[model samples]
Target chain A: MSPQSPNTKSLVEVRELTKTFNGLTAVDHISFDIYEGEILGLLGPNGAGKTTTIHMLLDIVSPSSGNVLFGGKNLRHHREEILRQINFASSHIAMPFSLTVEENLEIFGRLYEVPHRKTRIEQVLEELEMTSLRSKLARTLSSGQMTRLSLAKAFLTQPRLLLLDEPTASLDPDIADKTRTLVREYQRRFACTILYTSHNMKEMEHMSDRIIFLNRGKIVATGTAQEITAKFGQRDLEDVFLTVARNG
Target chain B: MNGNRIHALILRHLYLYKRSLPRLMEIFYWPLLDLVVWGFITVYLGQFESGLPHIAAFFIGALILWDILFRAQQGITISFLEEIWSRNLMNLFASPLKPGEFLAATIIISFCKVVAVLIVSVFVAWAFYSFNLFVLGVSLIPFILNLIIMGWSIGILTTAIIMRYGQEAEVMAWGMVFIFQPVSCVFYPVSVLPGFLQTVAHVIPAAHVFEGMRAVITNDGFPLPELMWASGLNALYLLASILWFHHIYDVVKAKGILVRVGE
Candidate 1:
């Protein structure tokens, strides 16, 4: 059960969020809410605007016409404050290539104004078992190690809401499990809301408390993994994912 | 521009530049190569060109000044491409940065790159040609203003094209830049150049600055007062670049061109 409640303090609230690319619509009238401490999984296939949605949430891609509220305040009006409380992690986008893993972490930590940034960076490095690779350039890291460093940046601020995009998409089975355990532990330790997106059904089943199915550009279904499986008359979230993405 | 934010961004790019050993070497790499190749050519021609004292001095300053101004814009191309390669261009716009902040950082970083090339060219010129640019310098303020506005004027337009298009436009920018160089009084005095060519030289703002600087420093000629005139043109170019860039950014963004893959 989540320690933070829906009524406690909602961290992120999206109202009729819609993003249009030229004449075509990418994310069409999507709406959702992330409470103070809950793991909200956004699942969809390729080109489903999953990344675009995340971009909108992060205020990178402006919405065509909608409002995103963080802490009950408008994102457009209080972007600086809202951004300070949010951090994103992904393996696809690399940090400064010239800076070592540790240096990259320190720069972002300072940007977020994290208290005792070095101490926090070291803690996260150890937490992710990335302490040994801290001295290496971020560009030099193998995919798995770079993912860990990106995670380290995500957790550097221990943000109010952590947005992740298929973070373990390419990790080995062993490292993937370790990453899942780290996510669980991170949530337990920090009490921040986590909004994750992945196509890995098993990973989502294991890591998410609730999963949202996004198809085309709409939220077609949302429920706990078991509930979604049972309600869709499917054996697993993957089957339900196919049903929603293809049929509905 | 929020000086501190631009400072941070400049530090970020310069720091990244420092990390790549080959790249850092390349900063001095091409200009040094240019100096060696051209210096040898100049040596071969020095005896013949020496008869026209003003033309000879013009060649020396032009050699270094054009290299500085041109190489500075080179940094702009690489920096934007760097962001593109890393996919962090998307990430940067997500930050608390406006377009002005980003533009200012690009200009400042470009200026810093100019300074880097300046150091190398100055040292090499002093060593090889005994061409001390300091001895031939004008009022420090206008001199810097001239180079800065000239560089950024071109830099923004070049960057705007890159942002709107891609590396293909970069080659176009390079071609147009040098097209003006030959006619901009970089190699010979306006007087020596043919009538039509001299008119083209007079039209280029850099020609005015270069010719004026040569006149002041070498000929001890009457004050040219070209600064105010050149500044007017540069200011217009700067305004047009910023607006044109902003308009391109908005049009591309609204049309969703900025989000295209590999764009």
Candidate 2:
């Protein structure tokens, strides 16, 4: 992984973002910056606001008391302008099941207005090793193939800021490793900044240049994997996660 | 609104229709069934009364026009429900596609579906029962346009309700348009309704449209005032429904309903 420079630009600036449901606060007034060209892993247990934070960044969920700025423009005011350069993928979300793999990507490519859309779709499919599944319906794919297809969409636009929430949650170890390697290589090649969340601590350690740990809707730790491990007096990220999850 | 984005959304649904037999069959099934059943019923009634041909025209014409409204509304609502069922709403919203662009695409799709159903109904009505829909002449355009606009209004409002409330409110997609049917006077004159319902029917754009259709068939000259009222009411309802949808969209985003909408 490339070292993140202190002077590096922040691709996404989330300030005092909070989301409340009924009487429950899903995310508190937490603030963070995802520097350009760095893989920032958002670590949290279930219901710890990891997905909620990602949603706020994508503007899929509105923040109750704060704002998110992408490329120095407020997301609320410049939604389409900013979102054109950004993309998101999650295993929990899906494409039109009845549509074929090529058809789905064709739609998204046009949606993002990617120039030379046809070539880009073929390139993404080949890069994700999904060329064989191009004509197959999305509903016919296995869980692992579906995850790859979602990743293929994330990679399709070569988005500057890709927010992926548990993207590899359903993938097997072999494919999951390849996905991580592919993401790292893509970030290195394109200088794409990613805000990634996953339950796999080892994968988090392997992929992230910096990590933000959240618990109970608040930021608990922010550093490199080793730094967080030492800060929490734990052996590694998994132990640190356990410490936070059990104690909080 | 970007034209490319809107085209992409429409293309997505087109791909679905192209691939699925059941979905393709849906475009022709309901409208044809309604036309055939009503054609035979009108024929049966014609055998019993003298000069019932005009009455038969009213029944068949109303059936065709009412189907236009129902199909138009279904085109928008069912298209939205497809996204929900497939869990693809987030993908579209997360892209550069704006809410207006999304609605524009769906409205275009609805218009296309309405055209398809109209062609089928027009052909069958002329072929089977010798009842010509074109007898309404150029006034037919505005009548059809009015009903479509009203359908879009109701469809947009239903989509807003479902967006805020999630799948639990999906029943409204099919049922909501029917709620306006009685007041719409699709099969009878508004005067036959209760006094309060007659008053209610006056405000509905479809009600004026049906009344206008009957006047034209009965050689009552052009129903200018009725068409004017229908147009004015449609403008209000369409504007209000669009505004309501935008408002509910914000509410859904604020409450995080988008995350769990399909589930």
Candidate 3:
């Protein structure tokens, strides 16, 4: 699918967002807009502020001197209201281990206050191909299964904006490819906007509608995958990432 | 706060308790052991005919009441610790669940657990030792309420510390309330303490609660003043603890440590 037009409404507007720890800035003055129904890829090296920025967008991390407006509403003032329409998934995050997969989804479904919760949960499980594992405890699932469960939770809410942090990091190649396709299909079906991050260059090019590359807490480049590759005078995003990491 | 969100959090913990035998056993095992041991001690003490009248009531009642505070605090702290241990804190905060709603759920869970502990302790005390906790009459309501609030205050404070400092501060989850036990006079009178320590005990809500509990047992008349002092102190401490938690929450967010808490 092609990227959303510039004229498309902005679902999230991050203005001069910055975060400092002690004297070191983890996310320096940075800003971007995630257009509605577009998958915005946040690409960066190991020390980049991609996760920190995602945390700020989720309001789990407070910016040093910036604001995030979701659907034209200030996140600080309307955190609960804004968050209700958003969901996040990360390989580094997890559900309650002792709870079964279905129970975990049930809790999140209720947390998001989705209408017809039981039916929604069943549908989400089936969509994620986790129907057979619904009764299995979270701790007992393999890493790939855990990843799918996390994705199931993200899709369970049908969130207006989904923030995914290296969500396929733990999945095998086949499962990862399927997950990418699933995400694309979900976004297409529901017009759900996503802010996705990953170290997989080919996957980034395949999944992101527009890519924002960050280095040392600053955005070094932002454009479509081909545009970014051409702008950096590199063969692909992998080369561009190397150039940014080594030369910047 | 939305009731659905609060119920979701409560349900999350309830599922954990429902599935794990160890978790369910924890709620009854420790309290029952404490009751059995203390019941024997009280019985042994009764054989001596000491000047302390109703020695069984004094010891057994104090043990049961003390469990109320411990279990109440654990209900909140351990529930939160479970999230941390499971690496699920980020998922929870990232959801629409507000901090106030989260605390409210823990408070309700604490109440339920406290009731469970109370039933087991009260019944076991009556069955084995013929000690009826209801002898304190209606005053039992305020006593339990005050202890529960105090437990919540300490639990919230511990949770804030753990949230900010991560696993390094987790020791507070188990140890923070016990620090109050020395000053709380859970078994002895506050008069046994040094002057300065006595002054310190006066500020603690649990201290007044235990003192009042003893008064009620000894028929020294109703402990209206002690109850009022405890309620007033609990009001102040609970407010202060909640404010402290909010402040720490903001600081953690600013420091960008919320995402690193479980790690």
Candidate 4:
């Protein structure tokens, strides 16, 4: 029931994107299209270049050779404009420790030039159930609360492109489930494109509309969870992931 | 490029000082302590060094101005290091905050910090040794500006090095200034150094600044030519430092080191 039309255009176009560090390649000539309003899960095992691909999309890491186009605009020439429509969140990084949660959110909101910031911040806080912790220092927050805050910051801008790296990693099951639901709800309400990465196979099956399986900086498979599992003659996506990760 | 975004960047650092008691204490306390310690040393030395006139003002004023330069440089470097410490550099760079805006905000924040440290040092010098840095009057403005510019140049270079080499180069944040100190001729005159070192010191804007300071304190009139030389040299250094930072920034991006900085 997405608002996107059957003829919806791609939001992100990656053409032979590759990244090499020193003598080693992290992402090797990967090409894909993320359609508007689709959840594209970049799935892979450790050192599969999943994170490196995400970094390229975010322009945090440069490609050794290739191009990424957002809305038909070249990322090299239109980075700030393209990035304005993109937002990213990760549990691996934390906000400034001394600033309160509200302060942190407010600062990020201002940086993004989010309109109606006060109302937007409050709405995001309420949506994430972080209203009570708004005044608490970011450093003092529990891990679960910090994850919630990270999600809140991502949702604050109502971005057209959302990049998330292991958004639910290390979360308790209850909170992880809730986080997934929140992400789904945010996507539903905003119809934003999501490029999500996670080690949780179940989460991938549940969340991603299409999955790209990468191994050793190359894409080994691309399909829906059921499609991938069926192609590999496996009962589930986890088995398919194990097959690809182990053999490739 | 964006004013509001730059303000947000500054606000992040300001909030750190606001909430942290130790951070606030460190700002005013260290300068005060340095002034007190140096003031007593000057007093003790003044009784023995009768050959040098206005030796007390020269030493005390030199200490305060030197601290100004150090604090200005540390303000930017330490604030950037804080981002690394808090694992916030990636977040800031990823946002709409352009690198130039980030540098501008850091410079403004550095000015605020140096002013705080300068005020405390000046107050302590006046209270303890009756050293009035303002006696040099309007010429003092150029001296302060020249030293701050030089400090910022060094700071920009230090940050670029840290960005390129990661946390391993963090020691440069504190150590780099003292490397310039000897060449800067902060505590002594350029002539006191050997001829070769004096040649090296002349290239440093701070050498001219200290020379100007000593000239003013000894009733030699405002060192206009020295101020002009310091200003011209510092302008070049500031431009070079900024270019160095941008160069390193490009390299850091290509190398994919930004995300791994704090770790």
Candidate 5:
């Protein structure tokens, strides 16, 4: 039986999604459904198609042979409508460099057409604790501050679905823990689905309600942290990840 | 296309220009220097003016207008390139912002930059050499409009190429316009080019614009035929460039080039 066969209502249904680059398959015939409000952790070693999957979800990359349905509409046909309900952020992605922090947030907020934009911008800034740096140019921001700004932009839209790629990759341990807790709180408050990725197994174990383990463009395992560990008869998710990486 | 989205994109770029002094300098400095150098030549040549009464006016006027074309093209291409350099293209496209709206914003930004540069270039030319661009009178409006549209056509085509081929094609942003410069007859009449090149020049909108400017300078009455030709050519090229841009945008999305562009 397929992991996605359960009748849980899904906000995002990725059906047979595949991608190839110069004859090399980057994402190979992957299928999954992101539930309405559960946190789905996408786990894979480097080159295992994590980023490619995220890009496909965002329609930044088109699939070679399949379709992605966002909120029951084909992404190819209703990209703008579907994108309006979704927001994404990554430490790898940078906002405009020369624009100030406030300018960047205001611009993105307007693009998303958030209601009551001025009030929302101020609210997001206050939530992120970035009121002091609002005037600073993006080029002058430290990595941690930039990540926070990226988060601010993501939260500004108050999206129904949020895609976060390595959201805590650049932060210190304490902040990383804090951001994870904040993300959890926001997901509950907004009732938004989240698709998150990270290399830190312990962090993934703590935060993910369910996990998908991918290897070489294929999903090698799928279950909760405890279930996946039990499948490999491992002590923890870290050992289970090691076992998959070594044997797959 | 959404107006608010387009305005937001334009405002995003305006902040870059507003925050940096060097960027502002780049907009007005080069054109001013070009006018000054050519103004001195115009004065020196006026002493030997056995042919035309206001040869200096022709040189200075043509220089300022040529910069308008160059600036208009650079405005669109450079702004698009900056997004790639900052790795912000993915973030922008991932939003609800439509591709058409993004392109519209760049075109609007190009117009703003051209206007700013034009005012400064015209001011410095008049202050230094007393070469009044207003000498062309009401006819000057159409002349400027035609040149700016042609610049946008070239600008859209360059941006399309960079989108399809990636940053390796960036050099074309600065170099593409010049390929048409010699044939443009910006400093001379179309009659000066070789027979075949003149045939080639006739197809370019800029050639007709400069020819019309010379006619107005020589008090030959407004050349309606030249203006009509330039306007017609601009419309055709602008349509083709826009179509080509949409095609390239689809190709970029399919190939996933947007993700790797800045790298």
Candidate 6:
């Protein structure tokens, strides 16, 4: 059985969650809901606060005035408990440099308190086709390889809610496709609810149940792949993103 | 952070040190410098006093304890700066790990380093200057609180500063260690400081730590009140530092300092 199958009910509900800097509001009171067994992709232009919103939802950035609910509780109140049930992967971050991939996974798995951590680590390594990279230091991994390791780490927590911030950002198209495939496979097999942000429109259109188009930190539009493309009078989701960025 | 996670991070750092070159610098070279440079000075002064009864033994312990506490202070936030340099601070912060985990792991790791430095410095003192912490080990518990607080306070304050200014402010983390080493009564009594500076010297917490250590070793027993005062001062520093750190953390995080720093 997959880790997420049991929690296929509505698992995350972000409400009017806003974050600001100085006088400028960054994530301006955006509200969204996420259910289990589905992938929701967040698409936005640079500086649109897509990453900021994700950071707040993951408890990385504190909200200015609103609540982010996770597993039916306010995230700030049950922060650790909520965190224990979620994991995140991003192309933009890296783990410890001195530790090998295996060691990094060991530390995170131990932190995750995964039962039979060694077996799980091996499982992830096998699944990701990364067993050869296990003993390699994280700093030494190619960007593509690091992305894979990050997905492995995200899978470690066996989280009900998995947040991916441009997990394939900066990857070649082939690797990006493979990365997306791996993430989708993880979701399909584990039934993990993925809250994702991606610049790659095709990837988002392919994977998301609903793609949220965010502009100036608010969800300007959200719908199925065709629903969004038709509303924006665009051929694809990428055009919708451009319309939101330029006109929203 | 949960207990198991904290334990896991602490063990990871400890294990990392056992496996890394920088750990060697912390565990071996840096403390060796403390012992050798200061050991020579004490040895040179030895001829003029030449083991002035048990008083000389107390002074030897005073020096060793001084090095340990200062290094304990040094260990606080410098590593956090390294995290910024390597851009790993955000990675850890963004993880499931909480702020408290970073603080606790830092303290545990710094304490371990301090213990290692103390052991080596004591060996050097006992070998060359007849100062034996072995005889004074019973009084170590009170001393432990003082150094641990100093280390944690320095760690928090440094983390705050690093969060604001990145790696450039890292030296400020260790600034007081070498800067205050001279007047902290590490080498001599505060009485030796020219009148006004003596009063100023007494205010820095390590002055009290050294004085308390000297009292324990020479006075033949632990001085509970004085040690408690030292610990209290360290606690106050730790509290203030943590508050300041959290404030800065909120500000920078809201402003996306973590992202800018990474860029």
lDDT of each: 0.75, 0.90, 0.91, 0.89, 0.89, 0.76
How many clashing pairs per prediction, in order? Answer: 0, 0, 0, 0, 0, 0
**Model 6 bad stretches (over 4 Å):** A1-9, B48-60, B128-131, B135-137, B179-183, B194-196, B215-225, B246-248, B258-263
Which sequence of candidate numbers ranks them by DockQ, best first? 2, 3, 5, 4, 6, 1
**Model 1 DockQ, alpha carbons vs. true complex:** 0.35
Kindly give the stretch of ten consecutive residues in candidate 2 chain A with the minimal lDDT sum: A1-10
Interface RMSD of each: 2.7, 0.7, 0.8, 1.0, 0.9, 2.2
Q: Pick the candidate with the highest DockQ.
A: 2
lDDT of 2 by residue, A1-248 (tens): 43456578888888999999998999999999888888999998899999988888888899998889988899999998898899988989988899999999999999999989999998998888899999999999998888888888889998999888888887889978877888887788888998899999999998888999999999999999999999999898999999899988
- lDDT by residue (A196-239, candidate 4, tens digit) is 99999999999998899899998888888887888889999899
In model 5, how large is the Cα lDDT of residue B175?
99
Ranking by lDDT: 3, 2, 5, 4, 6, 1
lDDT digits (tens) for residues B133-195 of candidate 1: 777655534755576677777777777787788656756456546766777676666788888
Ranked by lDDT, the better of candidates 2 and 4 is 2
Per-residue CA lDDT of candidate 4, range B202-228, in tens?
A: 899999999998888777898999998
Best candidate according to lDDT: 3
Question: On residues A1-248, what C-alpha lDDT tens digit does candidate 1 reach at each position?
Answer: 55245455567888888888767788888888787778888888787878888877777667898889988999888877788788888756667677788877766665566788779988988899888898898779887787788888888888888998899888888887877788889998888799998879998988887877788888877778887899889998989878877776
Fnat for each predicted structure, in order: 0.24, 0.99, 0.97, 0.70, 0.86, 0.45
**Candidate 4 off by > 4 Å:** A1-6
Runs in model 1 deviating more than 4 A are A2-8, B1-7, B49-51, B167-176, B179-183, B189-204, B218-224, B251-263
**Model 6 pairs whose backbones collide:** none
* Candidate 2: share of reference interface contacts reproduced: 0.99
B-chain TM-score of model 6: 0.85
Between candidates 1 and 2, the lDDT winner = 2
Which whole-number lDDT from 0 to 100 does residue B237 have in model 2?
94
lDDT of 3 by residue, A1-248 (tens): 45455568899999999888899998999999998989999999987999999998888998889999999999999998999899988988977889999999999999999999999999999888899999999999998889889989999999999999998996899989888888898999999999999999999999998999999999999999999999999999999999999998
Per-prediction DockQ comes to 0.35, 0.92, 0.90, 0.78, 0.83, 0.44
